[model samples]
Target: MNLNAIKYCLRQGVVSLFRNFWLAVVTAGMIAVSLAILGGFLLVALNVGQILYNIAGNVEISVFLRDDADQELIRTRLDGLDGVREHTFIPREQGLTDFGYALGDSALFAGLAGENNPLPDMFRVRVGESDMVEALAEKMRAFPGVEFVDYGEELVARLLGVTRWLNAFFLAISFLLAASAVFLIVTIIRLSVMARQEEIGVMKYLGASNFFIRAPFFLEGMAMGWAGALSAAVALGAAYHRLAFSLQREALLFFLQPVTDPEKLWPVFAGLLALGTVMGGLGSLVSVRRFVRA
Candidate 1:
């Protein structure tokens, strides 16, 4: 179409919004609430995910070595182990020093200083999967020169269980939210079509092409969806930042740290906007099918 045709379509779309002001508001409000709920849960899931990552990061296996073990060979074997991310070697003297530090004073280890160190040489190995930490530890024990491997097996297993449940819960909630949003959009668009039935018939009788007759309604739906998405984005962004800042201030809640940057949320905002627009367009198309032959 030419510039004038485009302008006319745009004007019609804008005018429709005002003509049915209450309907526009209601539709937009429903979408905004739905998106806000989805966004809120999404933020919670992300923050919780960060916490899980922190927990997993803090878990590492300690592989103690025999005094006569070949440190170089053990290191080489560790490098080849599946799921191993990294490993740090600790000499017997350094292990003693670390033990002393843990016990809090030189007096705690005065009798076992320097060459008198009784601690075994060890390796701190970090694995890629928290759930696999215990399995990896058991596997490490079977390796040559490995005296024993310990990784707080019970703790890692419990943490993995919690994280798995959290992920499953979020996925279920997300599916429900998406389904509800789609149903609401379809119903609202059907009501909108019925409200504008007379005008649509008049346009059809005037020989206007189906595309021209339907363009305004489609744009109207998109306008409402876009407005809702924008509102939800603003609210969610503000709330996320506020919560993140508050949580960060509490040392005990450090593990629950959230991503507060608005710039980082652009992709999420974009996804919501796209989802809104697509739902709106689909709803309008489905609702207008009957009027097409008018």
Candidate 2:
């Protein structure tokens, strides 16, 4: 289409929105509500995933040694092992002292000092990769003089499993929300087309191409979608910012830190806008194809 034709279509689209101002508002409101819910869930899922990731990254393997185990030999082997980021050897006495400090009751273990200490010498091993933790722990367990290895294996496995399930849930929720938004947009466009049936019919009879007949409806759908998404983004961003500020001030939920940076948020808002615009255009295309014939 020529520039003038495009301008005419755009003008008609804007005029149609103004003519049906209340309906347009309702359409935008519905779209905004749907998007807001989707965005809110997405933010929550992202933050949870990040917290899990941090916890997994800090996982450490504790290798306890038998009393007769050759500590120097085990240390040498550990140094040669792959995926072993670093290892700290804790003597039995030091281990007991550390435990006492952790418990904040040194008097309870006061009699257990020196020869009376029952704690075994242990090596605290940090793995370079979380995925290799189990393998590394197994290798350490096989080492001569090693009593056992404990790395909170169950906890790490559960964390990973929870993260996977969360991702699947997010995908399902996203699909449902997107489908609902598209359906809402389609219904709105169909109603708009029905309201202007005679006008579309006259345009079709006056040698106007199918594109010319459909362009205004397409623009209208996109406009509504864009406006709704913009509103949702602004409202959601403000709410999240306020929430982050409150949490920081109260020193609550230190583990699950909310994303408060505008630089990070702008991209998400842009993505939401793009998604809304595309859905709007697609909904318009579907409605016009069926209602505005050549």
Candidate 3:
């Protein structure tokens, strides 16, 4: 196409927007609302996943030992364990003292400091990965002198399960929202084509190429979709910023801290724009092809 042709196509594309002003507005509005809901859900899933990740990282296994257990044997076995990252041996005395300090009254256990201390000697073990916690705990349980191993096994399993479920749910929601947006775009573009059928037919009779006839509709669809995505991004960003700010100020939500960095969200915004643009182009291509013959 020549410069003149390009200019004409561009002009026609822009004109199409105003030609169906209400339709365009409605299309853009639907896109914006759909994308906003998807983005909001994505943000929530991300924050929840982060919280679970942190908790998993801090998970530790406690191996309680009998009073007659050989300290050197236990330490050697722990050092040789495949998934063991580190281990700290807590003598009965230290364990009692630590327990007392945790209770916020060290004096409460001062009398039990020596022989009266009921706390068993234990090894606090940190695993290299969350998935290895269960296996490592089982191995430690079999170690000589090990009375029992406690690492909240059921809790860790539940946490990992929840993370997997959240990921699956997010993917399902994303697919549905994207499909709905595409369907709406297709409907809007098809209506525009139907409204201009006579004009398109006349241009075809005048020897206009298919590309020449299709360019305007394609551009119009893309503009509508992009406009909607941009609006959604702005609205969602503002809301997320306010939410993060409020979360930071609340003590109770300290553990549920959100993604506070605005820069991190740039990629998501870019993705939304790309998705909208692609959906618009595809919808227009599919809609116009039926009426604009080669």
Candidate 4:
């Protein structure tokens, strides 16, 4: 723990990496590959979740108004609602025009459009939360001048359920991958130690404490981990940008925008780097403990 001792440990760690260059590279490669797999899954899941939630946020309640109802009174009632994010009043004429647009040939409906517009005036309400849509719709239905409310209650419920299940599934997968990565590091460190068992035994005979003997190996493992993490981050960043850029030109892949901007990627970079170091340190600790006991 003194200055000289710390220097010695640091030198030993650096020396060991070069002394076993192939092993060091192999260990680092394993960490990179494992973390890359985990990171790729996380990136995809996060983007998908964002897109789904964006769609969910757009879910709105449609409140149809009676033709004879007081429009101002209905507007006032809607404005007073607690969870409403925004509301757009759609006039009967606008509704007919939208319907004609959907039909793709506005000229096809030109004859009967004005006098025969059968659509009712509507208030389209976007709520702050998807779960609040049903409750808001119920309140809207009871308000005077509101003819009916339709919020696609069943679809909202199903979408929420799917999101919850998807989150749970991703969490489970993350834990499993993390544990596997740790175990892999442990195996790698153990092999490195086994190769240098005689040196460790000689150090023990020379009055070296367990901490003195273990610190260098632990540092070496951490170095490998850090190196591996940097590699994975660079690779993932390039791959993510390439995929995101390619998807931009394809309309069908509109919802598949992978987040590749540097600002958004900083956290992911930090997380993978930290994860690699911890796994490496843990693997070293496990190997040292087992070897010392033996």
Q: Give one digit per residue, the lDDT tens place, for model 2 in 1-294.
A: 689998999999999888888998998888888888888887887677667767777899999999999999999999999988899999998898889889997677989988899999999998776668899899999999999999988887887788889999988998899889888889999999999999988987888998889999999999999998989898988898888788777755777677766676677778788988888899889988988777
Least lDDT summed over 10 consecutive residues: which range in candidate 4? 106-115
Off by over 4 Å in 4: 63-84, 90-122, 128-149, 205-209
Clash tally for model 3: 0
Error of 1 at 172 (Å): 2.1
**Which candidate achieves the best lDDT against the true structure?**
3
lDDT of 2 at 169: 95
Question: Scored by CA lDDT, what does every candidate get?
Answer: 0.80, 0.87, 0.88, 0.83
True-vs-predicted CA distance for residue 187, candidate 4, Å:
0.7
Question: Please, what are the lDDT tens digits per residue for candidate 4 over residues 1-294?
Answer: 799999999999898889889978987887898888878877877786777767778998989999888888889998999999999999988777777889997666666666687789998889887767788888999988888889888889988888788888878887787777778777877877887899988988889988988998899888988898889888987898788889887899776766666676777778888998988888888877887642
Q: Write the per-residue lDDT of candidate 3 for residues 21-44, one digit (tens) a residue.
A: 998999999999998888888888
* Whole-model alpha-carbon lDDT for candidate 3: 0.88
Candidate 4 clash pair list = none
Which parts of model 3 have CA positions greater than 4 angstroms off? Answer: 1-5, 62-150, 206-209
Clashes of each: 0, 0, 0, 0
